[model samples]
Each structure stands twice: as structure tokens, then as C-alpha cells.
Target: MHSFESDTTPNRQEKEHPGLKLALELGPLLVFFFANLRGEWLVSKFPVLATLGGPLLVATGLFMAATVISLIVSKIVFKHLPVMPFVSGIVVVIFGGLSIWLQDETFIKMKPTIVNTLFGVTLLIGLMFGKSLLGYVFNAAFQLTPEGWQKLTLRWGLFFLFLAVLNEVVWRNFSDATWVNFKVWGTMPITIAFTLAQMPLIMKHSIEQDTSGKP
Candidate 1:
């Protein structure tokens, strides 16, 4: 006997467990990272994923598969997609498919550089336009004072630009294997360090839990 009146809040069921969301997002990156490291073994097992016969190709295929799986998991478990992952997934598919079909790793290697730089420039440009676009992008994560949002958005915009530059430098100067390593493991640790350093910033601007941007 289902009631006509809804028991759940509008557009809200159970909140997604944050840890779960993080795992879904990070899992595919790990697969790509590890596959690149032990690419011979992975390609041996799933040869079709490596028709192009390059380590980078194998890693890109795994990354694309993992992105799809992550999105499906999020949709099923959280009942909706998160913004950042959705954006990333779209980029991965487009870039990954291009890399596969072109049989060139450059397309995949350039994905992060393009995505990060675009985000950075777009955020900063939006600010110049008197819009806190970061607010729109991360509204689900935190609510901040007007001043706080401005400062945080500025810092994040710069950070993204730095990441873009670093990616370009690494991929340009290093071999494909080394570049892949940096993309996953190296960038992750750096991001963790930066996130930890942002605790103070988060505290300063934080509102109530309901307003903290976690669903």
C-alpha cells in the first residue's frame, strides 16, 4: 500500500556515503596507474583492451572502463551523479576513445592539462565577470561567506592552473610510463597535501552541517 504522499524529501533519498563516492572516483585511476605499471600482465589477460599494443593504450582503456563503472555505481548507489565526476567521465571517454582510435597516446596525456586549465581559467574568468562559478561547481561540497567563497575560489583556480602546468611539464619531458605514474600517484599525493593544508580555509568559511554542502 504505497501512499500518494512521498515519505522522502524531494530530490533527496539517503545521502551518499562520502567515502564510497571517493572510492568510486579514485578506483579507476588506481586501475590505470597499476595497469601501466604492470602493463604486460594486464594486456596479457585482456589483450583486446590493448589492441594498440602500447602501455599507455592499456592504461587508457582501463581508465575509460573504470570511469564508466564508477558512474554506473554512483548512479545506482547515490541515485544521482556528482558534478566533478560527471565532467571527468565525459572527458575520459572523449579523450580515451580518441587515443584508442588514433593509436596515439598524446590525446589521453593532454586530457588533464586541458581539463585543469579550462577549469582554472573558467573559474578566474567567471570571477572577473562577477560570478563565483566555483560556487556553482562545488555548491554541493561547501557553503561559504561571500568573501570566503571569493578567496577560496581564487586559490582553487590558481591551484588548478598549477596542476595544468605541472602535467604539461611532466608529460613533455618524461617518457610515457613516467608520465602515467606522475598523473596518478604523484598528483594524488600532492592533492592530498594541498587538501590537508586547506583545512584552515574550510573551517573559516564553513556553515552548518546542513549548509556545509555534503548531501
Candidate 2:
């Protein structure tokens, strides 16, 4: 999880809490996956959940709750919420609410598309104003030159737009199970692969100094 702070220098507590950070970002996702798998059992026990429709609807409610909890925990632990996740959480609540109220899966399915597109547009707009917004998210992880930040920001913006389109294609054309599986198995791996693929660029732009003290 990216800590959402303007301060380039992170405090000691934030620096020491990577495990909590990961939990905040990934725990809700895991809950969503598990809820989808066991939604029938969940409804059987709760009974109130039936009004929300099938397994997907139940999972959507649980997903929304988990997302809110994740954000709360993030704020409490890090004293700030990462902008992207915060925005994502807001969309999750709104769309998830609509999904439950209307008993329609389409709303929940569109959540990713909306969130990704929002981020993609926000990044592109920041770039238009001569801001490398991605740098704020990644400054703690690596130091890159101005040109490097520009290149990386552009790549990520386009990648986000691609993800938005991909989500639309999957959810619109595929079965619910397939969409859920794709959200978990497909997106995570693709993102990791994309991040790894950027290693060459990252290394080229890395500001690290040689141990031998030669520039």
C-alpha cells in the first residue's frame, strides 16, 4: 500500500510498518474472493443477505465493508490514506451500494472500470499540468530523474486505461465466476508482470550510488 503523504521523507513508524501496509491493501481483496466462494454458506447463516441477491451480491457487500475497514486501518496506522486507494474505496462503496440496493451485479462489475479510468485520467491530467503524480506514489521506493518520472507516469496512465477497458470486456462478455477469477488471478499477475517489465527502465534511472564511490 502506498502511504498518501506529501512528505517525501516518511516517519520511522511508517517505514517500519510494511506488513500492515500490505494487509490494508490486499486484505479486502482476499475477503472479496473468499466471500464469493462461500457466499451461499454466508447467506444461509445470515438469512438477511438473501435480499441482496446471489453470491456475487453478498460478496459485493462484504467487499464494500472490507474496503471501508481497510481505509480506516490505513488512516489509523499511517496517519493518511493513499490517494488511489482512497478514491477506489469511495467508488467501491458507491457502486457496491447500488449493486445491493438494485440487486444488480452490473454496478459492482463496473466499479473497477470506473476506478481505473478515474486514476488514468487523473494521472494524464496531472501530466498535462507538468506534474509527475506517479512520483508522489513511488518516491519512497525509488528515486528517478525528471525524465524518468515523465516516462513512467505516461506508461502507468496508459496501463490504467488498458485495465479499465479490460475490465469492461471481461465483465460485459463473461460469466460472473470468470469475472471474479479474472479480477483475482488475472489482474494481479498482469500488474506484477508489468511492474517487473519496467525494471530495466527503473535501473537506468535509479539514483543509487556505486559502493566503490565512482559515478
Candidate 3:
């Protein structure tokens, strides 16, 4: 559970609350999904919610708010920003603003697809160059054997691509509200399950502690 509070520095580190970390990451997403689902009722009860116009708009605003809340909580409780979430927050703010000002929900929806696809492409490309970018992202959190990193990196790269394809399918076919729900709830469960399913490989391939005591 302490992984939530874990320090992200290369030199200094702290324990984190894993459950709390997952909660913070997923909580805002659920908010956006539900908000989109019941957007009409929300707008009716609180007219302010309607200022954003329809479900997509409401979801965007809620998404932004939830992102901020998650960031603040992570800062206060964990005392540092989680690397991935920090990067994601920046993207959300930029894309969310574009969605609002442009009055196009497509921009916000594209956020995930773009981000995921970029990650996918970046990892695959990096691999071609014989570089392991996932090492940079998760090295601080978990110490894995070299083989472990390679396997994990490959899996994540493919997963990101899968998400991109899934996003395209969802948004292209479904309504805005449905797409938002899918983006949040749908992605979370799939990602977590995917992550958990990797535990065996991670455990099996993980590095033994370095004699020098550094990963």
C-alpha cells in the first residue's frame, strides 16, 4: 500500500500505499464515467453542470476536476507526484481545454488514444534502437531483472497499441457518454488485470538484490 507514498527520486525513496495509489488513479476516472452517464440529471440538479453542454462536456469538466483532485491528494499524502500521473495530468489539462474551447468532445476523447498510441509507438521504436524506455518509467518503483524489463516493456508496448485500437472502436461506434464510460472504467479494469497477470512473469524474472544494493 505504501507504493502510493513512495518517493520517485532516483536517489531517495519511500514506501508507498499500493491500494491507495490505485484508488487515486482510478477514482477520478470513475467520476468522469458516472458523470457522463448521468450527465442530464446532474445538469438539471446543478445548472452549472450544463454550462459545459451535454454529457461529453460535463465529463470533460469532471475529468479535469478529478485529475486535479488526484494530483493534489498525491502531493499531500504521498509528498511527491507519481511520474506517470504527473505527465498524464499535464496532457489532460491541455486536451481538456482544447475540448472545451473548441466545443469538440473529440479532442478530449483523442487524448487517451493519442497518449496511448504515442506510448505504444515510442516503446516499439525505442526497442528497435535497443533501448528500454520502460526502465526509465518503472525502475524506481520496482527492481526487475534485465529480462524482466524487456518482457514487461514488450507487453506494455503491445497493451498501449491495443488501447489505441480499442479507443478507436469505442468512440467511433458509441455515443459520447458511452465512450467516456469505456475510457475510464473499461481501461482501468483491463489495465489492472493485465498488470496483475504479469505478476507471475515479474516474480519469475525479477532480479535478485544487487550485491551493491542498487537495482
Candidate 4:
């Protein structure tokens, strides 16, 4: 087993500015959002965009391109691909490609549900095997006791499943614009709130408690 000291810090090659990391992660989503919102105008300007089907389809294509670009940029900047984004990127490319090639929006709409479920199941399965895979995703952010890691992993796994269900609920019953709005606006705030809610647990289990009182 790796020590807490070794598990907390990211490897040398994976180190990067937090802002850059945030940008790379969100850039593709932002591209998808803008492309969908401005699809008609862009289609008018480009003229060739109409051949892609519609606003949502155009957005899907651009979203795929942007996702791939962000992953490449991440590799160039950090010298390695981060696990979560890389997985998400792969899904975006596959689903987005299908959406465009087949001229169907359903695949693009279902991407989040699929990605979230994949993460949820993977984490839960890892826990069943006595492994806390969340550490791989958030190791750079916090160093906690084994108990904390287990608890956090379980919470995130369940939370991911909740998001998958939520995506299904939103996209299935709502219009495309509503779904897009919720995807761009709703999920982000909910995730931020969930992360903030975990701070108490993080503080309580922090490894610093073990060393803070040393003389």
C-alpha cells in the first residue's frame, strides 16, 4: 500500500495550475453550450454547418473536437492525461461522433447519463474489491485517512449514480433547449455544491491532524 504522503501529492509530470486544469475541463462543455445556443447564427455564417443537421448536431461535432483538443492540451501541458477527463473525453468523442454520423441527437443527449453511470459503477466495483478509486481522481486535492477515503469514495460513487438518474430525468422529459440549459447550468452548480458539502468530512479526516501538534 502506498503511504499517505505518497498518495497526496500528484506526480511531477501531473502537476499543473488549478486554473489551467479547470479551464481544460470546462472548455469543451463551454464550447458545446455556445455552439448549441448560437448554432443558427453560426450556420448562417459558415453555410456548411446546415449539412450537419441542426444546432444540436453542430454542437455535438464541435463538442467532440473541443474535447479532443482539450485532452491534447492537457497532455501537452501536464505531460500526462488526467483520469476523469480522459474517460469523459473518450465518451464525448464516441457519442458525439455517433450523433453526427447518424444525424441523431439522442446519442449526444445520452452521453452524460452514460458517462456518469460508468464512473459510478467503476467506483462502486472498486470499493467492492477493497480499493478506493476516488483517490486516483482527487489525490492532488486531499489526503485523508483510510476511513475517510472509503467514505468519500462511497459518497461520490452514489452521487455519480444520482447524476446519471438526474440526467435521464431531465433529457427525457424536457425539450432539447431545456436539456441543454440544464446540462450547462444545472449540473455544474449541483456538483459544486456537493463538493462544498464534503469539506467537513475532508477536514475531519485530513492527514494534517497527525502532524500538526509535533513540537
Q: For residue 147, give model 3's deviation from the true position in Å.
A: 3.4
lDDT of each: 0.79, 0.87, 0.80, 0.86
Ranked by lDDT, top first = 2, 4, 3, 1
Model 2 regions more than 4 Å off? 1-3, 6-11, 208-215
TM-score of 2: 0.87
> What's each prediction's TM-score?
0.82, 0.87, 0.81, 0.87
**Model 1 pairs whose backbones collide:** none
lDDT of 3: 0.80
Worst 10 residues of 1 by lDDT: 1-10
Better of 1 and 4 by TM-score: 4
Tens digit of lDDT per residue, candidate 1, span 1-215? 22211212223433437677668878999998888888888878877756855877888888899999988887776676666667778899999899989888888999999888888998899889888777765555667777778887888889999999999999999998889879888997987898788779878987765646776
The ten-residue window of minimal lDDT in model 4 covers 1-10
lDDT of 2 by residue, 1-215 (tens): 54466433556666899788878888888888888999999999999988878999999989999999988887887788777788889999999999999888999999999998988888899999999998988887689998889899999899999999999999999998889999988998998998899889988887874469776
Name model 3 segments beyond 4 Å from true: 1-20, 210-215
User: lDDT winner among the candidates?
Assistant: 2
lDDT of 3 by residue, 129-166 (tens): 88878888777667887778888889999999999999
lDDT of candidate 2 at residue 60, scale 0 to 100: 93
Ranking by TM-score: 2, 4, 1, 3
TM-score for predicted model 4 compared with the true structure: 0.87
For residues 130-211, write the lDDT of model 4, one tens digit per residue.
9999887676666888899999999999999999999999999999999998998899999999989999999999886345
Candidate 3's displacement at residue 90, Å, is: 1.8
